[model samples]
Target: MWKSRKSLVELSGNLRLIVSHARYGKANFHGSNTHPHNRIYIVEKTKSPDKSYIANLSASPGQKVILRPGHVYFMPKDQTVEWNFTPGVTFVAFHFGLEIFRGIDLFDGDSEFIERPVSEDFTREARELMESSDDLGHAVRLHGMIYSLSGMFTDKTMKAVEQARELMREYAPIIHYIEEKCDAQTTVAELVDHFGMTRNSLSKGFAQTVGVPLKTFMTRCLLRKVTQQLLTTGLDSKQIAEELGFSSEYYFCRFFKKHTGMTPKAYRSDILH
Candidate 1:
């Protein structure tokens, strides 16, 4: 028998979970959209009776991950994955974001696809949790399952969390300000004034440290908010624009098209329909 005298490590950080969507059903999804959130699938049945199932254009160049039944797969954020799912593939999917620091996804810009096999009981438990009428219980169980799945990539997950903490410790205030201002129109000059730094200095430092130009980062933040609202809300473009503090729906549509290469209506039609 093995016994521990005490806990090996105590958790001190709180990871935030933002669940954008969840579903349990058969689906035939095939696309290459680079979404803002990470995704997980607890697959049940595939069209094939053999080992081959979903064809994945994996993160590694010239590599593939053939998703099989009774496995849970984790896909990172901001990476385009070409998926070719067989017809009548059934799974439970969760589209979510995990944040170790506010406004920073732990798996942001990661390209790896992680997978682990699960027992029938585990799959059944997930299905039950998804089908439950109790929202609070469902949320709790869903979080537990996500945490358990994340533990599969223990070293990588911990390293990412630690890196986020270190980065946030230095840039939290500016990041918070950007997040606050991103829902509306934001300007680099405004950031310079608020932070009491020259435009060049702020831009260089932010880009070097954050790996994205300051203005570009702000635009991405705004774009992610716009995309989330478009997917999760039934509001029209005008309503969404007003709610998001855009000056006009015309400008909003223009910005959306400029970044996403599609109008909001077209985006919804292609993605949600």
Candidate 2:
């Protein structure tokens, strides 16, 4: 189970954010070699020729390295390693618990490594935030910067998700308008005016981009609304059927069963349970 309270090292005093910056001199030291209580490490390289050993793998500056000022590495916890800092190598390290990185899957196994250079502007902002002596202020600023950096990474992964959602948004207004006017007898002809496309063109575009036929998508939207109403409200089957533009309660039950393999009452009970 995940802990609700963060450890002392994970909490920022008065800042509500935990961030630390350190510079290492030429040193080779090994103590407990056990993973510290903290689980995440954000190491930004200011100077290099540093060597890090984790498990059986070792990483150095020259090999498999692309140096940019804003370079960052995310190291997770429970891994043992030795650090050999080439004399006078300066860097900033942020130590936090694994919970902060819960949404990010940076590693593939029990232990993993990540090294990437950050943008110059981002690096400068992080450095300035770290320089603040005010713990609370520093935490807030650092939190924002780290979040921004994390968002940058997330945006890369979600590029396809965003594109799909954008297409959905473009057609959503028309779909919503049709749904609203369903009781008043809306037709596909009305959608042409809203989307400015012929029937074939619109169908093709929606299928190719949205990955669903127009009719099927509309059915999904209507069913989703019906499900929401069923789960949240005390309306009965017949009332919901009329509200959702179904001809009869029996028809609505069949439609719901076909799509979900369960009757409305059964679905609701499953959700509540």
Best by lDDT: 1
Candidate 2, residue 94: how far the Cα is off, in Å: 33
- How far is 108's C-alpha from truth in model 2 (Å)? 24
Model 1 C-alpha lDDT per residue in residues 1-273, reported as the tens digit of each score: 987633223222456787877777775656555556688889888876443443335455544577788999888765556666767677888778777676777676566777889999999988888788867877888888887776674355455556657765667789998887767667888888888999999899887777678887788788788888888999999999998889999999998877655689987775564
Q: Model 1: how large is the Cα RMSD against the reference?
A: 3.7
Residues 18-90 of candidate 2: C-alpha lDDT, one tens digit per residue: 2322322222322223222122223345244334322313233312322233466555432444434343334
For residue 27, model 2's alpha carbon misses the true position, in angstroms, by 57
Q: Which ten residues in a row have the lowest lDDT in candidate 2?
A: 99-108
> For candidate 2, what is the lDDT?
0.49
Off-target runs (Cα >4 Å) in candidate 2 are: 1-156, 162-172, 175-189, 193-196
* Model 1 CA deviation exceeding 4 Å by range: 1-12, 49-63, 157-160, 247-273
- Native-to-model Cα distance after best TM-score fit, residue 18 in candidate 2, in Å: 31
